[model samples]
Target: MLKLESLVFDNGFARLPEAYYSRVCPTPVPDPYLVCYSPQAAVLIDLDPAEMARPELVETLAGNRLLPGMDALAALYAGHQFGHYVPQLGDGRAILLGEVKNAAGEGWEVQLKGAGRTPYSRGGDGRAVLRSSIREFLCSEAMHALGIPTTRALAIVGSDHPVYREDVETAALVTRLAPSFVRFGSFEVFYYRNQIEPIRQLADYVIARYYPELAARAEPYAELLREVARRTAELMAQWQAVGFSHGVMNTDNMSILGLTLDYGPFGFLDAFDPGFVCNHSDSGGRYAFDQQPDVAAWNVTKLAQALVPLLSVETASAAIGDYPQQFGRAYIERMAAKFGLPPGGETVPLLMDTLQLLAQNRVDYTIFLRRLCDFDSTPGALNAPLRDLFPDRPAFDAWAARYAAALRQQDSADATRREAMRALNPKYILRNHLAEAAIRRAADHRDYSEIHRLHALLSRPYDEQPECEAYAAEPPDWAKRIEVSCSS
Candidate 1:
């Protein structure tokens, strides 16, 4: 058995007043067993990777056993869900098991999603299905491997216990790790209730913990708000450059620390459709791929409103106003990097022109980017691989001519340029079809080998895993039928 003393726990969020959250223990599931484990994430919490295979670890992760210093709780907050304010929404199915300081003394909160009900249950069963649990567990790691900011997953515990979603599904639990789970909604709750004291307390706590450098600023609170806005802008830019559709960008789901938080109905672009909406529940396409940058700005404006008590209206507005410029600069820099062009180069026009061409042809986004990495600047060399991706041969050739001209402006060797481009463009992404296939195998046959295989493949998404070439291909016709909603 792993000793409780082996872990170091610190309950920082619990230091706030009881109004911030409710103390609760997870409702244990029966017959807990390990479904998947992340060795990489284990090191972040100072846990030995080998310990993940221990039988007792499953019980501890399933919430049947509490390690020493574990002060479990469910946080409270409110959010605007789909543009409507739900005045009170909290962690209905997730429980914070407490914080563990790693070898570097950095603290990470270890929480279990699908660990039963809390005061914020809102009359629904506080259980997570195996399908969704597997999705979160794998996608978290995949996002991290792609060099994107995101919360990490430690392990998943599965059980025979039943959960009712679209159908009766087996229950499961995922252990999630992040510096803090606080969201924009955390402040909105107190702001809406006119609870000024707790609002100030939360701000001070967050600044002291996450934004310590801002503590000495003339307007610490205002600077904190600006920093959050800046980080959120950069995060959204990365999402857009990589063709990731968050599906839902609710204020509550927006991480204050700028990490990718919730993983519901999220999908990477298979075809380059800027207007794609991954979440079926988004009837109006409010959170469509193209609208994400604007929606993210709107969400930051809401957070600014909550901080009005501490920051002047002018100060808040100015900080929020900085989002568009921040997002634009970040997006341009990332896209430039993708093409191996220096920032502010004339190559930007070619990049934009290529996007329009991609949309016209409905090209596979990932495959196109990966193929471009092998682009030959040499004359008379075949550009067939990239040209074949588009149906309009002449249109693609015109764009290639401009791209080759841009490449000539660079003074680097072909091999060096290809290597740099390959590093930025991922060879693997957690596609919707890949996730659905894994979920089906686990749900129908109780087989979990696909889950493990994907975890391994996604851990090194940038590498060319020749053995897993099939995973890098476009989805088949049947995969287009799979629709993921908010329920996913």
Candidate 2:
């Protein structure tokens, strides 16, 4: 055992009944090595910064050894995979070492991804590749910097051991910190099994830990479902605004806190295409870009069904019903911010219709939005910018006349709105081409400088970093149509 006293167990989920989790230690690996440790995570966890970089600390984090007082266990929860129910799916590869109350006094589950197999391993070897580990580290931090709630990565540890996939690769573990690892699938597992007491116990545990205010309500369980819907809608709206595609919308992958969790085969849209599908395995495009909002609602509806035992039929349906209106309001607000216009019913729909037209004409999503924010008082002034995103100048000129007329009716000055929109709209996104280039260099040449640079650039994506203007440009030729999938 490492050292238990220095360790604190605010053990939120562990407080739930025995069926919800399996108490198991991480099966240690061989020849563990440190890859990268985020000092920011150390600060978040309130661990000693110097100790976090220590060799022994790295070994413990890599699953080569156990930390002192670490009660590592794999959580048990089932989820719906692509709209199909998996009665028992849990942390196959990940092990929650324990919970720790950070300096802020907020409890966070500190888990080791790729730690080794647990009861939920499902006959497959529990391992993670270095590439995926690196992506998770960078993307988690990048999202957090972008003001999106997400599970944070404390460190990524690579081991000498190799694993087989399409090819042999080194193994790695990501130390993930989050308020809870419980998913929508977790609730689904017990409901499908008809385990009512465990469901109530788990719901109470969640309300106490994360949604404390809900505990005061007359019907905490029903209120919990509604609260989840509200948060999920807001989260989906944020994803839409940022042009992020989660790639996999499995119920197990959805965090209850409305934070982005899994980073497998995910991509940021470099060009605006509403139907953009990132996951190649998703042949039906069930989780396509435009379909995300609906998919999120669908997943939450499953959660609502699971909670029906604890909630009245009317309450459950009412919670589910709020999804459309909630998502609509949140999405419109986000879109309004992107265009620097205060949200109103009429202008928002007109903007949405205009977006559809642009999509039909194959407009560059980020570039078109950014350029529209910079137009002068007259329609003619925006011709060049509009034409750049359209097939021909005349096609854009006609659209620009209508767009300019709409803008002139607003009270905000064109310059002020432009400046405001610039703040809301990002100049840079983590484009697939750029990410691939960074990953390839790191894998082939052991160069992390480019990766580090890209991470920094994405941190403040909305700002115009004059020296880093090239980083804001769209992907070059040969980079489009690249397929990212759920496999890794």
Candidate 3:
């Protein structure tokens, strides 16, 4: 029902100087086929979900053809990868297929990842494998459903073309949607090159599109830096609260809008180990579960440094100084909500103590949090299920007593507290084991039912879907066989 001619395209980033990006067309892949599509994402751009199955849609998605008014380009940027600064790291395997304004008049950029090699492809084949594409497609929608800010996937297209990573995997492409693909590294590239004009121009363009309110301010650019810092702090807090370990917290992966960007080697904690590292490539654990907040702060500091040319050094430093407290406050508030306590309440120490107990016991993070919703102020209420989760029963009992006491101090009814906690705690997360099961089925058997099923289940993560209870259970020992890395 959707017509490509009806869509309005705007090339905002391409309107910038040639140095900002390289105008290129995605290399056509042979025999393109549709793998899966997201109906929820389809509505965002006013596209009919039924239209996604059309051959024309598949062709456009797979880079075999272009939609009307499309102006494809690859963006240029730099990044600090695992503490080392890379002077030039751009969209090597992705092509921005221009921006489309939906019926609501809001502009969204449609990008095809793993399309083909660009000027930025650093001696590597620019193609995404089926395994990683499926992971990203599922996880992006899952993050959005969990009420976390992130880029969304419209559809995924596959091809018969062979791309080599760990194996000679078949190629695939994911159509990702975002307001802007600009990253913190977008500014860093110019600053490092001593090209102050491009940096200023990029900042001005970002302000005009994303932060228009700041455009009228006296120090719009400084305010822009401060706003980005605040959003990044809050985003990191959300990730920590949800037990998500973004394996690579590199500067390039940090979105200027603070949405979780570049979903590679990302994993939700299976157990409450703060030191858990999901990426096999992260041998040093630079991006461990507990280290995310600090890594995010460090990345934000790099962004602040890039803005020094536009704002006073003192102003930028002051903005960077606010990150820690901002992160601390946001983390405390989110964690407190999960434990059914008021923001900045007196029972914060009890919440911290409980986390330590969970970590010590290696309790399953998602299960333990969801189970806490059943806690009541009564003495024996939490003894059976909750206490059994910990090896040290006495330690857990002591913590439960404190938690019950804290609950008694509050005036809310038992049901009210339970409902609040349930809302904050999700019953489902995109577990690594579950993702692998789906991946194996798709890759080996060419069966994609599991992918569609997961997309449906994860879209309502907070709700208890009894029919899919097996998806919520803790991972078995065999599940540990699944390993993710930067290659993912």
* lDDT per residue (tens digit) for residues 15-59 in model 1: 999999999999989999998899899989878888887777889
Q: With candidate 3 superimposed using the best TM-score fit, by how many Å does residue 75's alpha carbon deviate from the native?
A: 0.2
Worst 10 residues of 1 by lDDT: 1-10
- Scored by CA lDDT, what does every candidate get? 0.91, 0.81, 0.91
Off by over 4 Å in 2: 1-10, 48-50
Order the candidate numbers by TM-score, best to worst.
Answer: 3, 1, 2
Residue 316 shift from truth in candidate 2, angstroms: 1.1
Please state the error at residue 12 of candidate 2 in Å: 2.5
What digit string (tens of lDDT, one per residue) describes model 3 on residues 37-90?
Answer: 899998888888988878988999998888778999999999999999999999
Model 3 segments beyond 4 Å from truth? none
lDDT of 3 at 40: 94
lDDT of 2 by residue, 86-106 (tens): 888899989998888866787
